[model samples]
Target: MKAQPIHTIRLILIPFTLEITKTLMAGDTSILQQLGLQLTPYWPDQEAIDTFPKIIHNLEKVPEPNGFESYMVVHRHSMTVIGDAGFKGLPNTEGEVDLGYAIITQAQKNGYGLEVAQGLVNWAFQQTNVKAVTARCLLANVASARVLERLGMQQVSSDAELIRWKLPKPVTQATIK
Candidate 1:
């Protein structure tokens, strides 16, 4: 299956290829430059860099267009990779898919997180059997919570440390016969 890049007003969510993941895991910069992404300061937060190897492993099991793979959030104007985002995997039997994202320190506060999440959530809903998208953020992450809220996700659960949000598939009106 072909992996199609999801586009937003200012970002392009390109699925991470296995080769790219491996290269990243190995601390290689050539691939980034090869992809025309900015080098040097190009870096996601520690969390994303640490979790990517595991993401690659999981993607190996399910493969693209079916598995839960991460996407490189490319800034359209700068042509630089500003972050990463995507679902945890295919939707569960209940048709719920978990989503996550992180913007680089330099790229934060530019509304990239919201744009990326909105694009991914919309893409997920367009897929077969996807009924809802879910996300959670640390209680300290007010920005992330705001992004979810702006995306129209409802708070379903919360604790001292985290808040969970969900967005159900939008209802479409059918024409009368």
Candidate 2:
């Protein structure tokens, strides 16, 4: 089954399907119209554009969107595509999935990163097979590191160029009747 859109108070995470990925790569904004989404002129910035092919590759791996691939980050009230976020793929043998997100420059510093990351992390942990969510950011990207830290992800490792983070599933206690 296709994964459904994930809704948060101020944003909606719409999973990228093959059609959407192709349309995006082709520089066609008509898909946005069809989906009732608005696009900012600054969106699909170089970084976001560069990730399209990878997103398409991931989408092709499954018959449909499995919620483990990329998603368009749409602003709730404006219905605008402000960014993109999601996992690299389904959970690994270790039950861990890698997370990634990028907000358009115009939408930066507004907490959208944290909001979307929280939503994505929460969604991943809800899956029976997901035991941990992982992410990596450039060592120089302080803002991105802040978002991961805000989500309670701990620094698992770091190299000269990148810092890796991990958030283990939060344990929950069963309620007694």
Candidate 3:
């Protein structure tokens, strides 16, 4: 079955299919138009291109629901592809998953990062066996650190080069008599 699209406050997270990834890797915008998504000039960045091979490999090994791959982040208002974000892979034996996100340069500083991160974290926690989400960023990426912090993630570890953050699943209360 095809993966379902996830909706956030201002964006829609659509899982990337092999065809779509290939088209994106080729720097084709026709696919976006065919998909009825608006075109944005900031996507298909070098990082996204560099990561496609890994993404394809992962997808071939473990398909959706089992594989954590990149999702195209589309702006709800403009229906444009703004960037990409997702987990590195399925939750581990410890119920922990790694998260990654990037908003195109044009879309940066617009709070889309926070919204996407929060939405992904919430979705992960809802999945079976997922207890926490973790993320790591370069020490110099203050913007990314802020996004993680806004998601209520705490700094679990850090070194001179990178900072690791994690957010545990939220508690749900049961009604009592």
- Best by the TM-score measure: 2
Number of the top candidate by lDDT?
A: 2
TM-score of 2: 0.96
Q: Please give the lDDT score at residue 124 for candidate 3.
A: 84
Residues 1-177 of candidate 2 have per-residue lDDT tens digits of 578999988999999999988988899878898999886687778888899999999988899998999999999999989999999998999999999999998889999999999999989988988989999999999999999999999999999999999998888773212
Listed in order, each prediction's TM-score against the native is 0.92, 0.96, 0.91
- The local distance difference test score of model 1 is 0.84
lDDT of 1 at 3: 67
lDDT of each: 0.84, 0.92, 0.83
Write the residue-wise lDDT of candidate 1 on 16-96 in tens digits: 878888888787868988988776465755766897886787678764545356898999888888888998877889899
Cα lDDT over the full model 2: 0.92
Greater-lDDT candidate between 2 and 3: 2
